[model samples]
Target: MSQEITAAQRQHPTRVASKPSSYRPEVQGLRALAVLMVVTYHIWFGRVSGGVDIFLLISAFLLTLSFIRKVEAGRPLALGRYWMHLFKRLLPAVVVVLLAVLAATALFVPRSRWSDILAQTWSSLLYFQNWVLAANSVDYYATDQSVASPLQHFWSLSVQGQVFILWPLLFALAAVIARATRVRFRRIVLLVFGVVFVLSLTFSIHETYTNQAHAYFDTRTRLWEFAFGTLLALAIPYLKLPRPLRIAAGWVGLAAMLSGGFILDVQGQFPGYVALWPLVAAALVIVAGQTGSPIGADRVLTWKPLIRLGDMSYALYLWHWPILVIYLIWRGREEVGLVGGSAIIALSLVLAYLTTKFVERPLRSMAWVDAKKRRSGVVIAVCVALVAVPVAGWQQGLQVQKERAEAEAVQNNPGARVLLDGYEDQSSPESPTLPLLSSLGSEWGTLDGDCSSYDDGPTDPVLAERCVGTDSQDYEKTLLVLGDSHSQQWLGAIQPMAESNEYRVFALMLGACPFGEPNSERRPECNDFNEAALRYAHELKPDAVVAVGTAAHPTEAQDNVVAGLPEAAVDLAGFGIPVVAIRDNPRFGVNMIQCAEANGDRGDDCAFPLSDKLSDSSEMAAIFDSLQGLALVDMTDLICPDGWCSPVVGNVFVYLDDNHLTKSFTASMSGEFDRRFHDAVHW
Candidate 1:
């Protein structure tokens, strides 16, 4: 987190920045620059910098040196005590920032996100936010801006924390191997790190390609950077390059590190082979050491302002992201202008300094904290307690909100059958806010059984295995619903219709995969699942087949499409079963649940325009035109009426997340849906 210490820093053992006696002010300066780059990319560019990679290398590099010194000198590893020392040094600033985020959430962020913020707060405090984010990445439904968990940046810290604890154990093992084999301890350590570097690099390259979103936060995928740092540390003593070459290497390394935001596509190319550029540059700079040449980049790194910034880099990094998040929420916008961004940075630096001065320094300097295990335990307990307060409050609040929502859903929400007798004038709660506006996330209809949602099965909609009968006791006829979650949402509404019509509701649904050609699929598994759903639809030989008729994209005026469709609908019609394709609902990247909370009384202010929001279902409506038994249930008018789509309708939130309707909203729509549906099939 900090730069290498000059003799001056060693005197201040409680200093926030980590210090090794082999002081390199330039490296500290590099740390400052790296943090600045990260902050810049986050605010102005929405890009990632090689700066984090640089920090990752430096942390491991410093730790490796400290461990090697202890091993060679035959000093006690004091593993537990050293670990306590790191915890004391690293945790205070984190706890302070997390508390600040909680405060901001209470003030600025919507209650709709309280659960997520609370969860992420706990994850960040416990140092495992990365895994949480990785799991959310594969969940197609988790995609949206409102779900931007404040503690997301802690993923790097989580990775660093894992390595901090693990790397020492590695050195301990290396010491044992050296003692037993009569080998040089340094050589044993080098061998261990070399194996790690190779294994992790291989995994990183493969996983990055296979699942980049999850891989981005995977600690295993990032291990090579740390291992490479260890290797660099082991090699530094033996690197006997001349002064001129070392100076040249230092400049080249600095430039490469700076090039990350400009030259690299951080998302697509990072934590893989592309990471070698910044990581190797870091190694070069470390090996380069402080050059004697006046022109060396080292001179710039050691500048007083840069060194001071490095001294507070850890705090700066923690505070910047959350501050930016709060600012965005306050402004109710995604990106900020230059002035607003500058204001954010200025405020971040001030807050970072305060955190370093009051929180980190006070706890780290406590005489008992690092000196006694009992006090370290107490300090750790206190930090946990500090975090628990807000997390517990938020969870309790969410539970209360859920309870209130259920109560409201029962009382205020009119049954569609009775309401359809008159013009649609669904009643709204006197003041429907987050608790009611976003109540539907939990209220959304869900179905998952062997036939409805299974890991292994033939998913062809006609097959009995892929199909589940929702109400088999009333099964006078069959109502088969097929396709992805969009189609699945309809189950709540259609279940009633199916029951009333003396039909059993059967659904064969995949998460994001639609019934389409394998080539048009988003993932290979999706393609396979699509084939299964298609086949099951054919096998079930149902009286009716329900599916979403459109595919979507993010581009403006460009969402409508049958780009993902190929042979499913026309071929299904050949079975003489009516294919009821519901027009795909418009999608939004904004978190309407949160948006409604921020906009106050007229939640309609958050409404999305039809031009930008709508996705095309007309493609299938036309393609299925001449195919008998293939009915296009154009419900476009229902989803986005008159070129505008609002999140709330009749006081009920439509989307549970971004695209799919909530179970309650869909359930209420049964009357209208049943009417259109019957008319479409001419039943």
Candidate 2:
């Protein structure tokens, strides 16, 4: 990639196209409004600005009209000419902004985030950012206080680019279809526009209600905002509002848009029926045209200061987000002091002005005229190379980093591979291994309960006899272990214990089980896992049953699981096999080995204080209290002693990932089992 860039740079000369003097200030003013909305919303409230929504409408209107005009002049909509125009207009500013951000990200973004920036940069340059982000399934409201990427805003720009790519084809198709049908060009365009608008609107509303996150990134769902503007262009010749009415409509529209953008949160229905407010407002404002004077509409929107800001709006928008994000990164917090934030905003404005004046204006004003064909193409190629080079380098860097991480894990802790390849007994008894002292301890003993069942072996008489002798000899002890990946993790720890103890461990487990009663928690998966486990456990009629689960960051609903379980498990308790509740261990933020590699330190040197790692999940405590008469084990003391938790103890590495302990770490905790069992059970 780097070599390709070098070759391209050597072969091409960069050039820029001059914008015609007839270019309107109102457009810049609109740009200013869009930038202002995006910046303010991001810094203060973290939301999508109606400003961008306005821009989308304006872009649709302006570009469609331009294309239609060219087509009417009897010229084919030349793809190369259209693309060259777009490249010259958008790329220079975007390239400059992206380079600045790329540098800033390297200096400030954590290695964890570098890969994301690298991916986004490539996606942004290619105008596929929305799809890339959607594929990653990034939670727009995730609470991680990482610095925001400057290029994060490019998703909208990419959406626009994607629209343009197809819009021309659609426009040409509509023309051809209209010409063949003997219908007017304008009517056909309006008809197509209306159809697209309805589809987009319907999709937006449905997705917003069902899955707003998905709706936000969906291009098809967002098409109506642009189609609305296209429809306006078609209607422009037919509908003319009186000046007073047009002005009134403009102000009312602006107000509605502002209200919706400011008042709406990410949680609310977005880009749906609610989005119509801003889209309609933008349509009205444009329809009012420059002639309509809706009282103070001109004064409010066309003010010199606003116009100046609008002129630099493109540059300002380009610069603001990265600055704010870098500031957040440096400060190690999302909150910027009011004064500091204001200063940053002011700096962004000044930078925007300088960029607009010195960079944008100069470059855009230089007419390549006759040089437009080859020289302009060369410049576009160079810009593409620039974007592609860094992006390729970044992707390669991630691959290297992953390799390094794995190598580090193995080098520093030889058994890391063994830990990750979790063990399960399919044919025979499995060996025990300790989990990390951190969260997800290795305590999964079978609880003999009423619901325990027999496991019949295959047709193999020998294996069937072994199963009957060992597992079904006495259907007196039934046990269940249900939970997240954490619960599945305890299989190695308890399989041996269950066999020796003569109990059938009924594994009613699923990944991410929220150990609770049916219907009490809203998590459907958790409810289902418990429902099946509980039903099966109820049927076994063993002496007593035990249930174990992950207590990692236990929520209120999880607490309900513990509270609700005692009554449900009363049948097993009645048989004298007391219900045993196991308390989970603390969790480290990142995998112990991975964190060590990134920190350039060893696990021994980097272990956090026990208090920091150990979380007292209220849910687990409630469960313990709920089953007071039953045996309960609080494993915190075993995992952390004397206010200290070691990532590596007794020469064993701890966590296999951010949360779950390594098998070796869990194996070491087997001693705790003996101590707890001697006191709790009479085997």
Candidate 3:
């Protein structure tokens, strides 16, 4: 929104106006340098852009200095005036970018991805993009750059806006307190700065240890960096430095700031001591500027090219990230190597410069820049509303379309449909035997797990107590399939086989349950769900108990279920009752649905091989070997052969997530699974 400004002689009751021409070209050069570091780091280095830290210091110095000078001059501080200036400076170009991005996304990205883009666009417009991205917890160091969101660049702006909203109030309050109590303004301000600094520092460390992702985005954790700048601001004017000392500080600061760009890497735990280096460097440069030293800001930062970049820095920062992200996504790699990444950076810079020249500068110099007669707020509101309304509608429409498409595709491709919904009913005793005629529409009715409500037992369409027809059978041979979704996913295949083989399969699975002891409050759910599963297995007196999951170990039980199971199920020598483990299929981390849509394949042709899906790591191999008193079935060969696994094999979709095979794929592999089970367990 734009703020109303007038040529009237009015000023705020608590502020004084500084000279209007206090524009510092050197600061612009600093901004240019900061943006360059951020863009380069994000695209090629996978590290914090020391540039952002530098920018934060600049912001703190400029804004704090402005506020303090006005307050000290016996003039009123108009919060409205400050907001107006900020709004005019920030809004027009941001709104333009949002509109352009919204248009580009609609035209280029798949319908399935539109929802994410829309949400991000809205957040970007609101300057809340950082929080939105933080909530998603995207890993910056991850090699998969294709999944990077377009609006991820807005996090810095979000942090800045958040700090801006608070810094002024703190300054005003500290000033008022000093005046009221006859305390020196500097002392009062410094005390407030110290308190904020301490609180922010303490919280940042705690958050970094507890949740680094949260620490990165949370305003509380970041407030200290800005406060550090604020502290430097209060001390600057009081210092009257000698010429040589000022020159040395300037050059040293410049070297420290520039050198920091090369020294810092992504591995550094950020916002800790590492950030202070750049912040201090920026502050030193600013302080040196006032003295006009030969080795200071004027000699280096005011160079033509640096000034040019600095003039466009704000626009560049906004534009560069999205360009790089979209380019990386287009390339469809987890990590773009440095060469390609550098090319992306070059392109982003070109666009940034063009955007700054055409969009930001013109708007700032317009005759209406400070006009109060016309309602600029109304114009901004309209502009924002136009961008927001379409994006929201597009997002909602895309969601509906995706759901419809997913439903249709699932219906048409019975395998994916079955896996999506069949787990619920198939695991129950009454409905354990899925009708052979049932297709993808055969709904599972909802399953429960200790960690998830999936196994809480059917309350809806309330599954009959004996769905598996277990009461009619002589419950002599019992098999338990317990673990996470990886284990539960097998119900469609295993249940059918168990029913035909005259064996009952008892399940004690939990979603995301690693079979470990209680960790969170959710532990109760795990305990209760496992207890129910174990009770049923024990009562059935099965000949064999199968613990099936991609990642379940014998000692990792929630309450030592392995020791509690009837001794008949456990034989020191391969256990009397053999456990059967089904190796999970490959999982695609990228949203295959969106990829399919983008490729215009109608969601059928886009799939990768199992071997190509994930790295061959010890963690995966270990998950396959953790079952005790059981025979593990290595199905990696069933789905993958010659070191390749296709998403669609024999007209079957192999997986829904990173692991669970689609029911269609499961059905296709049923014959293979049956053979593996028979060979391993002698069933």
Candidate 4:
């Protein structure tokens, strides 16, 4: 989009053939507008702007025009040379940003975010950031695990990378067909893209509705936008808008792009039918064809200020998100207001200009690397290697830090003391050690990689090794624990009970899924997984089914909390299995370990009101009371103890992240858990 790039992505001779496509300042202006929309939405609204969708279209539209022209001209397509040029041009600026993020992460962001940042960095470099993000998008909890990483914005860039690589192949195939079949090259290419646009758009609409959180980052789902652009490109050579219509369309399109964020619920509705708002708008502006009328939006879009900004748009887009994120982390704000957003925008602009001028332009235009295909390829390889080596070192450093933290993990483990010695006064340090305490959420009771966690789900995989029994061959009563990660977190506490009593532990846990009503949450495969678990339970008919019975939907801390019981328990009771339901824990909605690191041991500073964390989820208990064999186990007191639930209690941290309990802390509650189990179920 930034023509400062000499990637030769668009063919040289083709640009002449594809006149009017030669220099579309209006398109560049659209690019500028898109970047601004993204930055503004991210900063003030914490929502996706749909502006990125516009860029995706424009990028594909231009590339398709040039490639089709080349294919029609009976050229070699210069696949090797074109790819080599892109490698040299696109990656240098990206690498600089990756390096900058790494540095900023170490300096400003908490150690909690380091690993995720590193993962995103590598993912971005490999151009599969969207997949990585999609994998992590839906987890055991109701909310995202961490603050949006500095590199998360790179997902769109990854999609662009896919387009850049794959779009040419489509054209190359079209070229082959055109030569062999005596069909018009343009018509063949158009036919192929039209087919792709329909198929991809259909799949996208389905995926977005069924699994929207992930659909936002799914490359498969995004292909429609890119393919749609190709279709437009194929049509553009024939498009000739009248001056009056062009003038009207240019204004209409600009108005839509500018007003999209304000008028739409992008987060809930985007990456689906709603995405057409921006994509279609950009398409109209592009097809409107730089009208020379005073009323034309191009007259505004081609303004010098916009053209210059558009030149920096790529760099600006790359730099703005991280800058905004780091700035918010530095200021300790969950969301920013006008002034913070302005400051972030100011700094981002300054950095964007600097990076474009110094890093992107100079590196993208390097004459030495541009001379030969082999040389350019070597430069690209070297640049990637440079980033990878340090990232590898940094990831290893985090591993070493985790080992040290685990070495100290034993001291933090107060076996059985939570119930016996209970609530020992302890002062939390100003901050927990970096990487270790910050990384504890990942360090839960190891299922030895066999047990499926959030990563394996919303696709459920059944495993048995992590399922412990007094003796698998001989157990009087089989205990099946069911639910998601919150359900899995209690494994340590429940394992002790399994050992003491003669019961085999069968964990039918799916991350973020608890068998309940209608599968309204609609996490992917959740309903299927829950149904399968119910069938598995009926087949096994475990002596007792234990589950974390309440759903704590994410909300503000001050909101009246309502923890509803999943209907799985009632169904289990119907199956004649006495159900043990543990009350869900308090949710702080921020990473507890990270909060402790920042705020120290001040319970008041770190803790929210117990009332805010728990409501009369007791209604669930009453519902179960009517069921013949269902028992409600309320341990809210164990978690929140006082009126305020402390993040760290009795020298052990409580919540692992926002809601789930620490494995060590849960283990420490063995006696209380045991006592409560006997009182509630009387097994």
Q: Estimate each model's TM-score.
A: 0.85, 0.69, 0.68, 0.84
Report the lDDT tens digits of candidate 2 across residue range 22-137: 24555556556667877887777766777777778888988787876655544577777777766766777788888888888777665545656776788888889887655444
What's the CA RMSD of model 4 in angstroms? Answer: 5.9
Q: Is candidate 1 or candidate 2 better by TM-score?
A: 1
Error of 1 at 604 (Å): 5.4
Q: What is each predicted model's overall lDDT from 0 to 1?
A: 0.74, 0.61, 0.59, 0.74
Candidate 1 residue 437 C-alpha distance from true site, Å: 4.8
What stretches of model 4 exceed 4 Å from their correct place? 1-21, 141-146, 415-435, 443-477, 496-503, 510-532, 549-576, 588-591, 602-604, 607-627, 631-644, 670-683
Best by TM-score: 1
Query: Can you write out model 4's per-residue Cα lDDT over 585-623, one digit (the tens) per residue?
Result: 777667777787688744467787777655554565676
Better of 1 and 4 by TM-score: 1
Model 1, span 1-683: residue lDDT tens: 01121222354445324434856787788889989999999999988988899999989888887887665444678889888778877887888888888888888876666667777888998889989899887766563544366788999999999999899999888877776776667778889999999999999999999889889999999999999888988877679999999999988988888886689898777889999988888777777888867898788888899999998999999989998888887777788889999999999999989988888888877885667887887787788888898688768776786677567654455433333446654446473432253233455455433444333334444354445555345357676677677877777778778767777666765677665555643777777776666676676677877777666544455444343453566677688776777777777776555566657535577787777755444654666675545577766566565667776655566666656677777787887898899899888
Worst 10 residues of 3 by lDDT: 1-10
Better of 2 and 3 by lDDT: 2
lDDT of model 3 at position 112: 38
Task: Kindly give the stretch of ten consecutive residues in candidate 2 with the minimal lDDT sum.
Answer: 425-434
Q: Across residues 1-683, which tens digit of lDDT does each residue of candidate 3 receive?
A: 00111111132432234333447777777788788778777777766757876777778877887876666554567776666656666877787777767776666554435556776787788888778766666432121224677777788788898788888888778767776676656688899989999898888778776677756777777788898888887776567788777778777887888788677652245566556778888877777764565546557788889988887788778777776666655665656777887777777677777777786677566657457623446556766787878877766665565455444442344432233223332222222111111122222211221212224222322121312322214434555565555665566666656656766554554554433223343446555555454444444445655454343221221111222222323432233345565544555555443443345332335544444544353454464355455465666655554455444432334544334544545554555567777887775
Candidate 4's displacement at residue 538, Å, is 2.1
The CA-based lDDT of model 4 is what?
A: 0.74
- For each predicted model, how many residue pairs clash, with residues at least 3 apart or on different chains? 19, 28, 34, 1
The C-alpha RMSD in Å for every predicted model, in order, reads 6.3, 11.6, 10.2, 5.9
